[model samples]
Target chain A: MSPVSQTRSPLDWVKTAISRYWGVVGVLIAWQAWVTITGVNSIVIPHPINVVGDLVFNPGVYLANAGQTLFLAAAGLILGMALGTMVAIVAWSSRILSGILVPLGLIFSSVPVVALIPVLARLLGYDVKTVLGIVIIISFFPAFVFTAAGLKSLPPGSSDLFKVFGASRWTRFVHLVLPSAVPNWMIALRLSAPPAVLSAMLAEFLMGKSGLGFLFRQSATEFATERAFGTSVIATVISVLCFTSAVAAEKFINEKWK
Target chain B: MNAPLSSAPATAPEAWAINVDHVGKTFTLDGGKELKAIDDVDIKIGQGEFVALLGPSGCGKSTILRLVAALEDVSTGRVTVEGSNPTALSRAHRLGVAFQDHALLPWLTIRDNIALPYKVAGRPVDDKRIAELLALVGLSGFEKARPRQLSGGMRQRVSIARALVLKPDVLLLDEPFGALDAVTRRHMNVELQRIWSEQRITTLLVTHSVEEALFLADRVIVMSGRPGRIIKEIQVPFARPRSPDVQRTMEFHHLADELTLALEPEGHH
Candidate 1:
């Protein structure tokens, strides 16, 4: 193996990282600059400084809300991933189960969860649970689709290798299936993470007494546009965090493995 | 179809590494059309003989390897490894296979890929044996290199080393060196011959190149395509411990020419 050391210093690496991702950094800077230069009412597009300041000053409020959303989303992510994987394996291994699930999963995936939100709110109540349920439904398809595709996507030669090597069912899953599914799992994770937060917000938007969504609606009604804009800005940051984490994971995998 | 040939006397009279007898196969695809891939093909490989199946593509050469490896079943007849049904053998450590594509696990380093047979079989592999294989394949320094970082030649070497790590009774290679450039292919041939002789394991190579068949094999088995059957078997009486110099010998050329004539269609022959 080659040495791990890179030519650049840590600070230099950070600079390089920012430079390499200039498109994203450029957008952020342009957005902040435009708001600062316009001198418009904070309601339209509050300056990034003010929005960030609001986050810092109201740390307890924002962090707690962010934490709540993350917890529920994480729960949904785990639940959906597990169920989807088992269902996918069953579908791939058995013709009868595959026939049953193939169309059923598609039909379940087709019906919009957003449309079901109202019914969910009535049944599960307009609370964190409803939002979590929404995330599960919305994220389920990617897990199911990717796992099934990943299982089937093993090259034609792979099955032959399996037979020659006498790979047990468990070994096949661990050695072949798991690594093959990593890329697809990442894809599903990326697609699902944002929906977790979005569904939480949607739930809050429909029914809430607290959280960023609640704050936005409260400010909107009171017409304190700056705070409403500030809350929205914070939500965008949460999204950036999700997107960046996925990107980082992808970079790590490509470098370390393939 | 010809009767199954017994193992040659040169290696051993009683012990056989591969015993494939009257093996036949037919595949019925999704459209319900029938495809006969092999037709009562029979070949016996002695304990240490290096046999090559030489013919044009689609001659069921690969199918034979797969059946012996127990990757696919012979719809009729039998393939046994040391008289045991290849599939029934609890551990596949008895056989190693390398196909056209070097199916080295992309996630593992070269060292790890070579060690996978032992890893998956849950047995402690002798590090010394692995090092010897790496040295034989000329891959000692690149153990930590991943498959993607390697050139095609290097990857194939890693695949071979991985196959040999288990020290199986038989080694099956299906067009293993076909994808390499001419220079690399020739180099690999010499390397493979040296390694096989040193290990003394029975080796079966399936290829379309008559020169490759002549160069690497002690005996060449040629097949006819379209309901694939063994058409001819030619023995190379060339001396053991073949090197690069052997490729230019009259014996090598003469054997290659005859096999070429046998492989060609009516007009070309």
Candidate 2:
């Protein structure tokens, strides 16, 4: 074998890594070039380097706010998914209930869900609980709709087989319906994860004592332009991480379920 | 090998394993109109007997099978098994059924699919029985494979093994090999015959193939389409352990021709 084929060099490894992350590298290069060329006032749009400097110098501020936001988002997501799944199971138990709730769920899901945040803040009072509630409401509809669809979409002829096998209603639900619904449920999870985080931050921005959203507002008002931009960077990182993890979880479940 | 057959006693009031007593079915369409699918159809299957309901497409032969399997209720009459309602048999987990779709759970391994009836009945999973069925179906080495990974014929074999896992008192097969090619279907028929001979469970098979019905059934009942009713019944004269050679016999050909003629369109007659 040729030496090049037998042993890969350090330069070859670097070349592969660059090719894989070229898009991200290109975006960073373009942002730096645009800032340098325009020389826009730092107050309007901080330099990328200034934002990085803010993040590095003041880690405690970012860390505390990010921790709070992540906690609220994760907790609210769990609560909303549980509530949605319970309601779906209740609807599945009765034709009359399903008929009543399915259309209502569709209506609620189609409505501008984020638009309700202000109204919810007014009604529930501008507290951390309201922020949590907003995230819950944002995530609930997809879980309900996707799970309802999954419960009904059984393998062809398997329902008849279940009936003929003398399966009880509970047995059928446990073995057939629940397992079948898992992949769709994972789809709902992946679709809702990033939005869950975004909505939590938005709620915090509207009326919260502390969070990344509050930090952004505080920094901007005080003319700490670099700190505000740093908050945005952290928020973006968090959302991407949440979305990537959700996608990975969905792939894992789909492989097992299908 | 002579399997022990569970034939009913001669003095028993219900000697029949399955009785479709003047059963009729009517289905409602999208509109308020009613379409009669079966009309005054009657069938009696003896214990340990293999009977085939043979009819062309659109005939209610499958409807009759569905009635006996308790998948559908008769609109005008009753279907009974062992002197009780068909639903009783199903509820007791003594009825086995295989449909044309195979109906194997795609997510489950072949062994788990066979063991599903046990789980449904709230009985412990019998690993030995599942292994035995896997061997019987000629799928011993494929126990860990999923249904989608197998060929169509192999999937149907897994379906059949699942049906027999509980050693159900009655077996209902609705064109289990209907999705296969001609050669594969014929091969399935031979395998099914050997399997049925060994089990000797009371079986009702629904199919449109004249040769399949004759080759596998102890008796063949032909039905007419559009408000399905029995047109004719023929007792298969072939002995047990019937090999593929029986299909080449003159008697088999004559019976096949008769059944084919029965299935022809009314205009042709």
Tell how far residue A256 is off in model 2, in angstroms.
2.1
Model 1: per-residue lDDT, tens digit, A88-124?
8889788899999989999988887668788888899
Best by DockQ: 2
lDDT of 1 at B35: 95
Candidate 2 has an lDDT of 0.89
After superposition, candidate 1 runs with Cα above 4 Å error: A1-60, B1-15, B89-92
Model 1 chain A weakest 10-residue run by lDDT: A1-10
The DockQ values of the predictions, listed in order, are 0.47, 0.75
For residues B87-176, write the lDDT of model 1, one tens digit per residue: 865365577888888887777888888888887787896788888888989888887888889999998998888888887878889999
Interface RMSD of each: 2.2, 0.9
TM-score of predicted chain B versus true chain B for each candidate: 0.92, 0.94
The top-ranked prediction according to lDDT is: 2
